[model samples]
Target: MSFALYLAIMMTGDQIELVQESFAHVLPAAAGAAHTFYDRLFTLAPETRALFRGDIDDQGRKLFLTLAAVVDALDQLEKVVPVARALAIRHVGYGVEERHYSIVGVALIETLRGALGVRFNPETEAAWTSAYAILSGVMMSAANETASVKHVVAA
Candidate 1:
């Protein structure tokens, strides 16, 4: 999809349906989707794979379990974002670069489409893409802002 089309959807506010569709139609797929996603993610970024301890497949299951727990408590994003932000800061220790976000996004979308099967229509696809964009942008910005503040404090 063109950037123009993405912007048009945002401008027209037609995406609320998409968002609702996600919370309704897609939430069930999230756990399986995330497991598959991290599999491909680790495969593509083998160096980062070492970040996981013990059995790789078990680690993937544990990951989806944690995310599912958080999704169940989505209303408590104050807790979620703080934990996420702290983990993002720790990504430095894992050698996760900002560029890895794109790879992660790709695996995520692929996993969603795979898990959703026939229900992953074009509109759903667009919505997922939009959601990922917003997620990635926010996460990267937060990480960057934290990094800047830390830099200033250290200096």
Candidate 2:
């Protein structure tokens, strides 16, 4: 399944609503959720831990804050594209490869499941999955473009 087709099929008004609503539930425990997300990410991809330099807690906070902003802008996704692109470019500098996105997505879903518990139903999971897919897709595309440009310049 191509990313474009997946986005077209999975990202709908109802799914957006589900993601927004489910994320609202995560806000109260956002700190914990962030911690869980990082923990899961490191566990899933231990090598990726080399990408972080400073405090894990601080990084987690930034993660949640970014996520909050992204969730708030879901209805206007275009508004976040530039920000995501810049972030992605920076991530490329941090040794983040394209495959790390999938590892991060799995960690995100697990974090949501742990945070939402019973509230994280199949529909909610699907919503968050779609949202992550869309966001990561944009980031990965931007990263790839940046890498290509750098390669061309280097060559």
Candidate 3:
């Protein structure tokens, strides 16, 4: 959501190596992020909890693992556009909203800050903000496309 933060990452010259490094550093925080996000979601909209199956503990782990794996893949995606498009179609079933993404981004950043400790400087924050923007854009585009196609992916 921060334009300046996005600009910094956009201008940064680092390529695949930089993205891979960031993803590596993020693995430890991913699981905690899933917990935090679900906590907040349940707190804010308890009804949303009904959307999930009874077995949610494993769902939590799967959520984080999928995010970490998907992000790592994004860095090396020979065709990120198609992947995002497919994911968008899949996400339609969940009734995912653009606003929920902001919540996830918040928990994600907080988790990274926790894991990174003192290493989470302004530059790191900027990098994350930019990365989220790109990631969120993918979700948004996918949502729109899914709506048009009447396709859906389970959450």
Clashes of each: 0, 0, 2
Q: Candidate 3, clashing residue pairs?
A: 90-153, 93-153
Top candidate on TM-score is 2
Instruction: Give the candidates in order of TM-score, highest first.
Output: 2, 3, 1
Candidates in descending lDDT order: 2, 3, 1
Candidate 3 global CA lDDT score: 0.63
Error of 3 at 54 (Å): 5.3
Error of 3 at 80 (Å): 3.2
| 115-138: candidate 3 lDDT, tens digit per residue | 677767667777676667666776
Minimal lDDT window, size 10, model 3: 2-11
lDDT of 2 by residue, 1-155 (tens): 75445455557889888989999999999888888888899999999899999998899889988998988877776676777888999999999999999999999999999999999999999989889988898899999999999999999
**CA lDDT of each prediction against the hidden true structure:** 0.62, 0.88, 0.63
Which stretches of model 3 miss by more than 4 angstroms?
1-19, 26-30, 41-48, 74-78, 151-155
- lDDT tens string, model 1, 10-56? 42244445544454555565555656887788788777676665676
